[model samples]
Target: MSYYVRERLPPRSTGIANRDQDRGRPAMQREVHLIGGTRSEAIRLAPVTLAMREAGLLQPVMIAAGKHTGTVTRTLAAFGLEPDITVEGTGNDTVEGTRTDNGDDPLLRELDELWSVRTPAAVIVQGDTTVSLAAALAAFWRRIPVVHLEAGVRSDDLSSPSAQEPDRRLLAQVASLHLAPTPLAAMNLLDERIAHTDVLVTGTTVLDATLAVTTRRTPFQNPAVAAARTGSTNRLVLITGYGSEAGGEPRMAAAARELAERHPDVDVVLAVHSGQVDALPGDSRVIVTGPLSYPDLSRLLCEAYLVVADSDGVAEEATAFGVPTLMPRDGGEPAASLTADCARAIGADTEAIVTAASALLTSRFRRDAMAAGNTPYGDGLAARRTAQAAAALLGLAPVPDAMPVSVPVLPSGAHA
Candidate 1:
């Protein structure tokens, strides 16, 4: 029983919300199942949960379903959220696709049984994670409408190592509604022959999460991070990535060390993957620490003078905070961020990293000029638009206005 679109709103660009009608309804009765299993999912989806609740449209039944259960829970908590249901997953991250029957897999079996007991009207899956693949497939099997958040993102590079590219492509097949984060994404889906009406550009929810968390002014837990961030007159360079995803952690570490050494006042911090700590350069100035909680990470991004991101690219978040970022490898999503004026893909190596950082560091004019560019992500109401679209799919509300086409946002007093 797939929950098809009950009603689509009359095309209204500017309209007010229903103020008095059904204003006092209890939230639980309007259950909308949303699945999350990773920190990124939690961060991206938290704002949507809030928007839906505030709008009195749909109440999300957040189901914790993925690897990194602990991190996901903590990340959700930061956004004042907790999963209504937690499905302890048994599969690894390397699972190819969820198209096959995984009767033996405890995670898939659990999802199957859960939905069978009390089926949801729809299941909302975020991004292209293995968790999303499993959950989307399970929902499809049960004839549940799947709403794919952050839909239509594509990587041009076919040789990429991860299964993310394929996961999203498969998701496009079953999702009843596609919430594309940008116009480019919507175009990607349209190019694939997805119905124009099915795709909506909602901007990226990650920015919503970033904006909300930045206002909180959370304290950094890592002593090194805390000390480095506080009362520092010089620039703070924040680097993040996993060697497994981006390749050669050691080179990134070496680059950080070199950047720190060359610039007397500059300090480098690598909010690194746990496994790759030993592989990094052994330098006192380069503060290497484990992965940060989402809030802390957002705070660091806000405070960062410059961001040196590997494949676990923070360009979106960095760009959101008006921070200049340098991607160490080939460009991917949010290519607008990596444009010449703001961020750059300097090729993943020690020399490229050092050279780029040096250019930006020595020339404050260069760094400030880059940061002056407008955030290609949008004005930061992505979650709100997404909430409206999701509710509209279920006949709860009308669709919100689409985001503007992507263009260079030149801040006041910015250079060409």
Candidate 2:
């Protein structure tokens, strides 16, 4: 059964107002629009949407374009979130397929049409995806306030180095409020001449969502899932990558084979993207699988001895789990991964990855030392804080204390 089928959205008012002011009189609920399209954006928005729903402070109107339908579906389902509206079939191909030949133009038109008749008090968007930037622009055009989540992430040069940096900068220009994840991010916004009042350090929501997923309580039904649980002799080595170099399936296959060969005892799980599945290496030791659901991926990370990936989200999630990671990116690393040597940049060279994996695998002291360092991400309270800030911004009632996260507690006298 669909999780969203059980949850219903709250009533909405035309304008935002402070419900606290009208204690005796009934007050109308305001609608806060939350939009996302890509996998990363959807993952980050999960906690915020859940928070809004739990608080009942404001009615959240969820929106999405089908950029990553599977990922978006899994993530939203994990959090029991369903979009109030989707802009997929007005014109052009569905968001799940090709994103070329003026792909985003149709999305822009759809969003513009949505705003033409009914505009929310504010539009909340996450990350630097094209869909996010488009939504922010649409809200800005309608003179609706834009709330940018995970804002102020800077790349090497804002000259379209990876397409994300430019999108982030443009979103910053139009966003009325910027919820930066770190101090460096806040400083970046300030340096860009954004008002200090508009910028708030709410930490990253990814960690909050990552921590929320607990180990399965019931007996495993799937043989593959049951086998993925790490045993005494099994050391899990998880790999994920994107872009031209290591992101290619052939390159990832080679790296996986190399790692498996070097460490025969370790179990290598490679999360292959859909585009590169055809070239995946067929090896018994290396488990080649399609993109994992967020919960399953979180479970793997929690059990992984070492991670070799180029994704920023992977780096951040690995850091929160205290799992040592090898970043295969050529240039700069994400801010969360660059602390206490938690993540190391080794380019896309297969030899470098094997060497690093070997060193970390053999040296228990080294891995333990790095894992003990402070997480560059936030405490597990990012969702609550972000939700609180959003309520304050929207003039809604304050968010009540959130329920504590359910993690597996070790038996008394057992070490964490």
Candidate 3:
């Protein structure tokens, strides 16, 4: 038997120290490179790429997986921005590379090659995926500045035995510019001693993405949304779980049994990741579906009365879609604070989850308020603002102002 070690070497930030000494340098036109670990990052980057092109800033380059290359390419084409570079054969997604023990993986090598060839002035990496971390590392080694989108989220209980805590902590340390989505996220970054100057509250680009897609309405007008609009005879609850090790399967099972027993009229749909379908509970009412595209998921979300899951970013996505959500306590502190009506602390017993779901299904006032409260998180313009922020950071001429509105703070203990 052979043993292997999997570790990400700490990033080298001192690579550009001497270059910083050379002041009064002529302004140089810079390339804005996006390193995507998954299809979602590529999708999210589309609007930013369009906004950059419209602003006449540097052309954007996307580094994504071969499996997702076509999807990424088509998405960019829809937005009318062609990638200057595309790298393939990483795996099904970026997480494949992160979980691999080999430090000299081809994807990492490709990232290094991309950095060497493009030499971007600033690199924009969205979210906290493994690909983002790898790209940040590559940029740091090359002395290029890094801008992290959706930065500053924390779960605080790393010892609680969750994988996201390590991922988020590493991302925070590597990023040069932290583009946080909320004041709470910004505050979290500042408390971590990241300079206030380096952190900006840009709101969430996902919100912007959500608003743009939802406005189209054709998708929402489909049968699924219509069915959802009809309301569940028993409550229709959506539950999502990610990462096999994070207690997702067990939690979903436990919650399902409790809900089925306590509220037999309410139906529970478990949206298992395609990879984890075998783990799904065998209840007829506990419908198991594979992963869905954003638009399709948003449509489903529109119809869903409530969303239950342990996925970090999905809760906010649900909020943007005006779907009330209940998140496991382990999801993260930021999401918990944002979704008072739906969120319960991590250790929520089966009875507690059942109680929460029952309350949400019966209360018209709670549903209305939750739908109204989700407006601040995202309005589907994050891609546009993210584009502007990326351009400005690259020292390009300022993009025309289309800044998103500030998210309103929820009253303390309002959801509880």
Candidate 4:
């Protein structure tokens, strides 16, 4: 199922094109390439791959290296789709080593090889990572259409701390199709003058991923859940955030420590980012857990009394799970407005975190209401929907009733 594009001959263009024309179709056989370097990227790519497979499209080719590749391969295996091609470069370990003067590298070389061999109808790139940008450029150079997932997300301030504005801008300009998560995101693309015909508000594939994990129930529980349940009746606060070298880690740690100190009866679990686990503090009250599988992590969220994170997506997922969250507020906009009573924004200071934690601990009625307000982000069938959409774009047969899949929630403490 794997391929090396550089080593193979290009498929017969006349035959492929005529095949589509004869069937009064575009092309059923398409190639997808995902570019990124993180466990999160791997997780995000899974649903797309699943969607493609369910829609009868070709399995995707992944371009990544080092730990990132391993994580991606593992995620694909978890969903039962082996990559058709995996591209890794010699200098992939270092940023400078991986980049040439013109920004082309072994990864791009592999992509070129894949394109030559398959003549794929399109390529799908997700996120705002360097790999994605590079892949998009490569695809554009090759004259292949590119679909951008999670497009139209703008932080608005490129120079602001921890801003991904540049990547967002670059993606907005190059993407042929923009799969926006919300209507607002779609509007952002429209204001930027992107063709309206190219933008689609498909909710978020992440919500589909979240719902998929939540719907599955198993009796096997991890030790962490057992400990959390039997250890004490103390309030549980789950803290997560983006793990960039910016102030994200320190801010989360300081908040966790403050919550622990101010509320002795509470247990603060810091779900450290997979990249920054070593940076966490050594404190009994602040329990450190490794990066968990998505389903396992969702179950942990269900057990939590409150969740604290700076990530908007995590905050959204927490709300879907009915867990109240404390997010860092961007000046002027209260976090509650974005997430309802189930969520709030607090200062990174110890006093601010402690105060917010104390208030949530005391408000039983409010907590109950927020929990009730939580609903699955969408049906669990995002994978199928995305697959059908990508297939249609590629001129494949349309899948029927391609809506979100709905699944029942697992019992408390269920684990993979």
Candidate with maximal lDDT: 1
Q: By the lDDT metric, which is better: model 1 or model 2?
A: 1
State model 2's lDDT: 0.69
lDDT of 2 by residue, 74-96 (tens): 56776667666666632332233
Model 3's number of clashes is 13
TM-score of 4: 0.76
The Cα local distance difference test for each model comes to 0.74, 0.69, 0.60, 0.60
Q: What TM-score against the true fold does each predicted structure earn?
A: 0.85, 0.83, 0.72, 0.76
Runs with alpha carbons beyond 4 Å of true place in candidate 2 = 1-28, 66-71, 89-104, 215-225, 228-233, 274-283, 397-416
The CA lDDT at 313 in model 2 is: 83
Candidate 3: minimum summed lDDT over ten consecutive residues — where? Answer: 1-10
For model 4, the stretches where C-alpha displacement exceeds 4 angstroms are 1-28, 57-67, 80-82, 90-106, 160-163, 218-226, 230-235, 242-266, 273-286, 329-342, 368-379, 397-416
Q: Give the number of the best model, judged by TM-score.
A: 1
Q: Considering summed lDDT, which 10 consecutive residues are worst modelled in model 1?
A: 9-18
Per-residue CA lDDT of model 1 for 188-241, tens digit only, reads 999999999899888888888888887877788678778866777767788887
Worst 10 residues of 4 by lDDT: 407-416
lDDT of residue 368 for candidate 2: 68
Q: Write down the lDDT that model 3 would get.
A: 0.60
Listed per candidate, the RMSD to the true structure in angstroms reads 7.3, 5.5, 8.0, 5.6
